[model samples]
Target: MKKFTLSFLLIIVGFINAQAQDFQGMAVYESKTSTSDLKSRFEGNKDITPEMRKMIEDRMKGMFEKTFILNFDKITSTYKEEEKLDAPGQQQSQFGGGVKMMASMMGGGGTFYKNIKDKNYVVDKEFMGKEFLVKDSLPKLNWKMESETRQIGGYNCFKATAVRPVSKSDLRNIKFKNDKKDAAKTESKEKTTSIMEELEMPENITITAWYTPEIPVSQGPENYWGLPGLILEANDGKTTILCSKIVLNPKDKAVIKAPTNGKVISQKEYDETVVKKMEEIRKMNSGRNGNGMPMRMP
Candidate 1:
């Protein structure tokens, strides 16, 4: 009887261990981007009144402040924006469509899935009313673990840093160049004004991440992962994503799966398509007024 009881206890312990190994969790993160640079661009511009500048800033705030949920298990995870109702009267603004387009370009609303075990990712991106499934290898970040430590959501987290290349097409890199001298010269010569231009972006920007070993999962918000533990916070200069709450092994488990519906394409192909489409639009809009009337050129 003693031998039988010992064997039964061993089996029970083994079953519990197996269940523990299949750990799953859901993390809620809040992401925000700095608008200081955008505000500065509006300064000293006489054409934009104070109220107009405030309106623009408010719209930018709405676009950049968002909440995302990350559902993860051992090797795969899905990160997506948590939908929220727009403010009263805010949805009808003329800038709403443009802002949404810009946000989509910056990876704002999408179902992003990462499979660490397969070293690949699939992103469902919607741009200009077109859906695309971007499949590609996972971005590899050479993270240098730092000795620094901090607590996030009651979990001890360690710091890791890496440098990532900046995307030239990112709207954040655009700057309004109010070159009065150049504008005067252009108007005099070409009968047009140039008030905005894209700023040259650096080759790379540094990224800082905080991960907690307590979770023991290689998952994070957006496209960040491959850390020694679960990433709870990450910052890339302009934007910061931080975990607000985490549910470990919740009763209602989330389905962590890759999105399948969309026009299949690689990441490189998708970017090239966006660039080409933008170029076509720019060409179509050149020398045209806001009402779509062609401007008289000297």
Candidate 2:
């Protein structure tokens, strides 16, 4: 009887080991961002009409709520946005032209593939129907461990924090177009500018992340990684991404692969391309406006 019990325990342990050896999992992340603080900063501006504010708010609301999937193995992972239906009567076309232009200028969705073993990554993006494959090294994050811990999705996670200094050029919402009409209408040049524009210099931002060691994998949604375990939640002041569901050793083997259908370019090259393309677009729009300067929503 004792021998039979020991044999059963050994079999169970072997099975668990085999499963760990071939571990493949998928994690679903729900992201939410609050624009209330940002909205409050510009809510009192007179140049921004209520209708315009509503449109901007709606666009920001959509930007904040998103769903993403992370398909991962022991060393590699691919993160992408899941296709979702728009809210009732809130289609993209319904937004104002300025909102649409801003969205385009901000760029669209992207697929990120990371390989911890290789210490590299690739991002797939589309611009004006042209596809681009951005290749670069994995982002290095210096994390400071904390004593705080929490439970996320049934897994006990530990807290880690980091501070990243970003330049003004890296921010998408910092630039405000110089509209001649706006310049003439208001007394203070700064007050007449787009309320959303950033007037101060760039500064460092704090990032907080929670990771679980049970997963024993260097993977997370988007570009977040680099802890002793899998990241279950991450907050970077403006946005928060949390893992809501996890499926371990899925029935169907997820083929973790990098994207290949695009013109391959280095990350720097892609940034330059986007800058040049946007400049051309600005020039064309200015010519059409007949003032050699495009008027943007304040």
Report, for every candidate in turn, its global Cα lDDT versus the true structure.
0.80, 0.73
Model 2, span 105-201: residue lDDT tens: 3323467899998889988876555677888887678999999999997899999999876423233334334455754453373423334432342
Candidate 1: tens digits of C-alpha lDDT, residues 105-135: 6647489999998999998887777788989
Off by over 4 Å in 2: 1-18, 41-55, 87-108, 165-204, 276-298
What value does the lDDT take at residue 163 in candidate 1?
Answer: 93
* Deviation of model 1 at 74, angstroms: 0.8
The lDDT of model 1 is 0.80
Q: After superposition, how far is residue 256 of candidate 2 from its true place, in Å?
A: 1.5
CA lDDT, candidate 2, residue 88: 67
Q: Which is the leading candidate under lDDT?
A: 1
